[model samples]
Target: MQNLTTKLLAAAALVAVAGCAKKAPEQLPPPPPTETTPAPETSQPTGPVGSTVVPGSKEDFLQQVGSDRVLFATDQYDLSGEARATLDSQAAWLAKYPNVRITIEGHADERGTREYNLALGDRRANSAKNYLATKIDAGRISTVSYGKERPEVAGSDEGAWAQNRRAVTVVITGM
Candidate 1:
């Protein structure tokens, strides 16, 4: 009698446990489709031969020239052959737009003390600025050094460092 009572209780508990099991949730309705508006079309304006459509504009300068900056070798302030070529093109662009003013920003890789790197970057910027002065009015260009504060790429590797060491010619006004 005792064994039968225990068995009955066990069966009742099993049924109770089974009843508490979870059931699948009902499915929700799908979301409605979203409507999007078409973007306005923008075209690049054409300019006369040897002139930019938007003279002194950063976009025009970058488009007409290969790049707005010249990369430097590690820890070096001297301009390389390629750097010279790029600066030469930048000078010609500056010459074409006589009213344009530029700021030469010098940057250094993250391998030196803040003070040292700042000085190095200053030298780099001045190097580029001095070179550009030969082609355009010296008064049209200014120089600033960011040291390692603003890096083009973020990494400790040589590839990233190489990119960080650069002098960028930025159009400040007259665009």
Candidate 2:
């Protein structure tokens, strides 16, 4: 009888405690999509000249320039030869569309302190911006550093890290 009463009291207490817990809303929103397209292994321009690329559009930039991003070495913000080539293509494309404005987003791998990564990302962004500024008007290009907060690939492995460490030029205006 005593054990039964103790069990009942415990059960009642548990029920009371559970009742106080905030109930989740019945209609929770769906989670946001996370799928992302991987960048191509090569940066060579693949779009046919005078192709059906919409002028001053993001799609046009990607199709015309082959890549809007340039990968960087770990802990290094300097543009690689391949990166420069890609940037050169980008510059040529930009020259064709003088009304376009771009924002270079700098990203870092998920391997450093937030503050350090932010600074590194900033340097990477500036590197791309400076390179582009030489050909395009300095006022037409802007930069932003996402640091490690935005990873191109979600993993702790080297391959993922390599992809995440990059500066991506985004066509923000003149679309």
Candidate 3:
């Protein structure tokens, strides 16, 4: 009789405690679609472009640290003094934040054959990547050539051409 009473009392106490606990709301996940794309990501960090402060959860903190860094004339990938100035700032920012990795996207203006533009883009991106690696850790950077396939600004004028002839540094997430 005593053991029965004790078990009943413990069960009642457990029920009471459970009742007081807050319940997590059930989440309704997004519906499945005909096509699957990467989950939409919000720009969680609108902080200053070069700010060293990591934003949000370490997992959600990917930032576009460097934007469109410059490339050069019709047939050159060497880092010009002007281009070096742009990369100098990029390198400084990377050094400021230790746990970041990046990809350098090289692009070219639409003035050449596809293969030629692709090669040009590679040269452009590698130039910027090399410059950054010199000032920061080499392991933090990777380079890819998008050539003329991707353009920061689209058009045929010198203004658009200038924008396209460039290397863009993209901050990779989940560092």
Cα lDDT listed for each candidate: 0.84, 0.85, 0.74
Quote each prediction's TM-score: 0.69, 0.69, 0.62
Q: Which candidate number maximizes lDDT?
A: 2
Error at 109, model 2, angstroms: 0.1
lDDT of 3 at 70: 72
* Candidate 1: 10-residue stretch with minimal lDDT: 35-44
lDDT of 1 by residue, 1-175 (tens): 9999999999999999999998886987887643222112234353566664454467667877878999889889999999999999998777767766789999999999999999989999999999999889999899999999999999999999999999999976432
Model 2 scores a TM of 0.69
| Model 3 lDDT-worst window of ten | 56-65
lDDT of 1 at 80: 96
RMSD for each of the candidates:
13.9, 11.2, 13.0
What lDDT is reached at residue 84 by model 2?
94
User: Candidate 3: how many backbone clashes?
Assistant: 0
Model 1 lDDT on a 0 to 1 scale = 0.84
